[model samples]
Target: MDEKQIIEAVKEAKEKSKKRGFNQSLEIGINLKDVKLEGADKINTSIKLPNGRGRDIEVGVFAEGDLNMKAKKYSKHVLNKEEIEEYAKDRRKMKKFAGECYGLIAQPDLMSIIGKKWGIILGPRNKMPQIMPPNKDVKEYIKDLKNTVRVKSKKNPTIHVPVGTEDMEDQKLAENIQAVYTGIERTIPVEKIANIYCKTTMGPAVKIKW
Candidate 1:
């Protein structure tokens, strides 16, 4: 789908979103084409958001470079493998972080080895590995990557996100939301379900004409 199609769909989705009971919604722009799956048969996962999710995200970064150094200066969750696991060891906090953190990022090597343990808790919640280039600037990337609006379904088979705001001059929110939606779309299979919708957090549905 092109930009117009995504925008219109998000407009249409706003009303449906209201019936579900949300004060506001955000977009999670992910590259749908980039998501690769391990299994072909089953797709069992939950999209768990943070409590009072209406607030903007702090965006935690986990990298092996200066990003780690920067991340540590900001928050305790910003740490190496051993530290993260230790922090996650606290049953309640682990359950909360594992439940609500938007995404878990790492250098590719670390991801390949330790993704399994983290995946055990985060995978089912649509928070999976977004393995990044090892030397990428961790803090800066986290700012853009994490401050997204979510366009997800309510524990159903299909989800929607606000691709663009009807009132905004630019479509940054729309694009970001679609990217995240696209990533999630790739995570599932075409055979399972067909499409994802985008709409406003408070607006009604507008059909995206092809």
Candidate 2:
């Protein structure tokens, strides 16, 4: 997709959208062609928006020892090994907690436990905790997570992801849309992009006619 075309579409979408009481997220929808969905569930990846997500992204951490302590400083929700086990027992609570956080991080040692217990819940949703490398700063990871948008295309020809918020500048939103488009284009080797649409949370879809 052309960046200039994306900007024009973004501006047109903004102008066409009516004012809302709350900030609406600018989202993009891409329709792909000739892509196999046999293993589409495995097509999961995170892309950091060049201009950020224009909103806060909460990250939940599952860790122990010093890493757990450090994670507490950066994240509001930090679960130790015991708490992880406890969450595993309550499927509803675990699902709710997983939904609350945009991303998850875990100490390397806790990977197996998280995988074995929480994998069933987190896996399908793509909310699995990332294994945190030892001796790394938790703040950096959290900061990056705030700007990251996860892309997953499971058994579907179309991919939809949030680019930014409506309050952001048009150029920034365009850049974010381009970033997601380019990232997905590189991810799924398809014949061609059938169509691309941009819109706010409650706005009409604006098609980029490039």
Best by TM-score: 2
Best by lDDT: 2
Pairs of residues at least 3 apart in sequence or in different chains that clash in candidate 2? none
- Misplaced by over 4 Å in model 2 are 39-42
TM-scores, all models, native as reference: 0.53, 0.90
In candidate 2, position 14 carries an lDDT of 89
lDDT of each: 0.51, 0.86
